[model samples]
Target: MNHFFRYFVVGGFSLLVLSCGTAGDKAQAETVTERVENVKVSPLKTLQIDREINVSTTLEGYETVNIAPSVTGNIEHIYVEVGARVNAGDLLVRMDQNQLTTTKLTLANLSHDFERVKALSETGTVSQQAYDQAKLAYEQTRESVDFLSANTFVKAPIRGVISAKNYEDGELYSGTPILTLTQTHQLKALVSIPESYVPFIKAGMTLEVTSDIYPDVRFPALIEMVYPTIDASTHTFQAKLKIPNGDNRLRPGMYARTSIKVGEVNAIMVPYQAVLKLTGSNERYVFVVKNDSAKRVRISLGKRVDDMVEVFSEELAIGDQLVTVGQARLVEGVKLNIVK
Candidate 1:
């Protein structure tokens, strides 16, 4: 009876040990099963890529004029205030007549002396040298008077709005600018494009421009000027576009974005959403399916058109399935299940 009891106890212990071992084996097998992520992918393709470049710049006045008095004097009267629209040659300010009046008085005296000296010299009453001196003095005084007279009435140089007023009536002019006039009927957008695009950009090319201030408005601008020289350090060239602000709604110093169209080319294009930027770095990458596994590929990006982008990579080839979805949860060498 003791031997049977011993055998039963040992058998029970052995069965318990075997059960634990089987359970561990089952759990281990489950843990080792390859974790496959279900993803949607599209094959890369070669298409005629619309190579367009976008540049941001500020809108400047086509013509900016600074108004100031040529001679130092007191501002007598201001005809226009800020935001007042004026035409070219419009009288904007009038300086005090103190300098102009005094010059005219001197000119009158010089003229009287000149005429008297000429008459006396002709009659042999005065020397030729004295007559010549009086004539020269009169001419010089007349020129001074003319200069002061023209400057006394400060006129607008350009037909535009009065952007600024620096002085009021009865203020002394210390050679500071009294007003700033900007031509708002037409504005210019200066953009610096990559030097490689210089050969393709022409002076008459039409480009699309948008302003932050006018969000819903997109206007066409012509490339009025393209700088001949390229900046060596920046490897960029400047292009000026004429933006017509006929309504006088656009102002200078507003931010503008310009899109220039380059000719089409055959290139590998992918969806813009497929491109992923790695954390803590500027490097861009995308996942592609290779032999049923996800392969992360580093790529150089070019101009993006709408939802698609131009991409270049030595490791990538045409018709390779790219994993656009489920990429956020994928890593290099992860197994993939292509799903519809």
Candidate 2:
């Protein structure tokens, strides 16, 4: 009876030990399976960005007039220099007036003689021929006197400054400009628009004009005029606009940029790394992934700002998963593994 009892206890102990071991093994297997299933990677997705365009242009003033000498004489005094400001009718140069003064005195004597002859003819004290000769002489002398006044001083016709000093004091001014005058109160920017944009460009249309001299600066201007004919050499039409220079900050011959706001709105874009460029049609492409799978999608491209490019594609929906990195390892219909 004692032996049978001991054998029963030992058998019970062995069974209990086997049962605990099996339970522990099952728990460990479950833990391992859970960890393996948690390890997963997915493709990164980026939002869409808008587009922009850039073109080169120059800045110019609305009007530019050259100061030309009006009469022939020696330039006696130059009152202004390059970059000096002047008002309309301001004295620009002076000439020797000796000849002019003498001509005026001679004309005064001829006028006295003509008046006396007219009085005598009216009283029948002189012949008609005598009065006619005096009248003709008086008219010629008046012309001579008028010509002398213009030869004395070269004055500014417009409110401008001396742009160039071609002569100095005591120099000859023979109806030729001793200096160049330019008015910069307003500036005109001329832009050549491509023939494709002819329909959109017209007089009074507003556009933006900028200058590098004042970085990031822009002003409002209108399409003051447009050429009716297109330039065959460049296949573009010329457009002009007026820009105000109230502070005289913008000078003629200074470089400028003109920006035309064509369009603006929201869009989807991707990093440049995600886009693939090709020849022939200038088409761009990007890669999209879903459900551990990726495919190369052909996409149209638009304006790019910085590192991002506008993805122009109907196939690419907003918030679509894309392969930003590890694109080289991806292909059409290829399997993918999320890295992060």
Q: Highest lDDT, which number?
A: 1
lDDT of 1 by residue, 30-91 (tens): 64346689999999998996778899999888998889778887888999999899999899
TM-scores, each model vs. reference: 0.63, 0.58
Candidate 1 Cα outliers beyond 4 Å, as residue runs? 1-47, 112-135, 212-216, 229-235, 265-300, 305-308, 311-340
Task: Report every candidate's CA lDDT.
Answer: 0.87, 0.71
Candidate 1: what lDDT?
0.87
- 279: Cα error in model 1, Å: 7.3
How large is the C-alpha RMSD of every model relative to the true structure?
12.8, 22.8
Clash count in backbone of candidate 2? 15
- Span of ten consecutive residues with least summed lDDT in model 2: 35-44
Show model 2 residue runs off by greater than 4 Å.
Answer: 1-55, 121-133, 173-176, 261-340
